[model samples]
Target: MRLTQHDATAPTGMRNNYVVMRPQNLSVGVLPVHDDGSVTLVGQQRFGLMNYSWEMPEGGAPYDEDPIDGVKRELAEEAGLAASHWREALKIELSNSITDQRAMAWVAWGLSAMPIAPDPTEIIRVTRVPFGDLMREIARGSVRDMFTVATTLRAYHMAHQGELPPCLAKAMLASVR
Candidate 1:
């Protein structure tokens, strides 16, 4: 990460120095949904927030690497799951006012077991929660990770918009009701 300062002119024609943070590498997040409308979540102590967070499997990807490959790797490493189908859900600028850190998220289904290979720096715990329950937790502020929140909301939107298979959408939407 690098910090730099630049001049900014306000609407009132006042000038000031704007300090900005530039972060290296792009980030990827994946929401792995099972056929039963359950989604896998990973829990770990986040250094940035200094709190335990339950979030989608997420990690940084080199700018030159395909984000999907990073997403696939994170899903396997953090959740021990693989998906047969994938859909890009969101591209977000995290803390845009402060940093140039960007993230891409995906919703993946058709899950099967894989070998877990967590990062040496992380101790991850995984759980499968029903989609509606996950939504409720987000609403209750138990899950505050932006990547997970945005992707899960997008999946819900996709289900409602008929972007997903009928059976899968039905199963997913049914959980919310």
Candidate 2:
């Protein structure tokens, strides 16, 4: 929640000064798949970068809130989609050395169109791409968001491991060649 700089003497009698950041946030990333096997992605215009970045639907949740709930809300708000099936795909410490921020990634399917209600401050573009195409873009460095990259790779692993439904996995991986 705050950053502070402090100076201290080490056991070797050496002086050290460093800045410490305290973070109190948890986030969720959702990779939504359509029944037809395409995956939903969102393009967000980041103010800091003054450029648009493509990534899975993601948002910050209060530390006390359920990650699944937060991601479900994000999917609807950012992609205008709702999913009936959900699976926890990964949990990661995002930039742990510098911040306490943690993220939960989810794979969701059985999707249907929904009303989008994005935050007024956000400008998002939603698109659907075939699973293999999405993977290719990621491999080419087009989709560079850490959360999206992690979640997509995890989903690909799940498909190969037969963790996903057979039909869906087949549809998703069909274009890999």
Candidate 3:
């Protein structure tokens, strides 16, 4: 395989300037969609926060495993539900304070309608929240799970052009706080 080299000193255009070593780990994610137009999310106590907030379950992609497969595994491991139908959505560079990683977004539907076996390290509750509540959460800036809110809203926009379920839109309009 052919690879390009670039400079490390320049702030950008590193593709033609340098080659950096990759980290030892990777991550992938998915937003499980519900038939009723809601989404299955999770809540966990976060840093700089008093309590938990809503977010779709997600986690790492295993070595050599397909991103899609990784997302399915994450769903089962994080939410305890097996994912079936899915589609590729977006791929983004997840840059955080400590590391740079690739996180993929997927659209998964047709849940198994059964219980999940979440990871022991995770203290999360799988919640079925209507879009209205999520929109309100966004409006109030109460959604600490920025990824969850952004990805799901984009997917919802993709599915319905920002016209989420009618009740949700009505609620969003009413909750102008």
Model 2: CA > 4 A from native: 4-16
Give model 3's TM-score versus the native structure. 0.70
User: Each prediction's Cα RMSD?
Assistant: 1.2, 2.2, 6.0
Q: If ranked by lDDT, best first, what sequence of candidates would result? A: 1, 2, 3
lDDT of 3 by residue, 54-132 (tens): 7777777755877777788778877777656776666776655334566777767776765667776667877876666
lDDT of 2 by residue, 14-96 (tens): 99886767666678989998777789999989776777899999988878887788888999999999999998999998887
Error (Å) of candidate 2 at residue 141 is 1.0
lDDT of 3 at 66: 76
User: Which ten residues in a row are the worst by lDDT in model 1?
Assistant: 165-174
For candidate 1, what is the TM-score? Answer: 0.95
Better of 1 and 3 by TM-score: 1
Model 2: what TM-score?
A: 0.91
Q: Evaluated with lDDT, which candidate comes out highest?
A: 1
Residue 67 miss distance in model 2 (angstroms)? 1.2
lDDT (Cα, tens digit) per residue for candidate 1, span 88-171: 889999899878899999889999999999999999999998899999999999999988888899999998998887788888
Q: Tell me which residue pairs clash in candidate 2.
A: 1-22
* CA lDDT, every model vs. true structure: 0.90, 0.88, 0.65
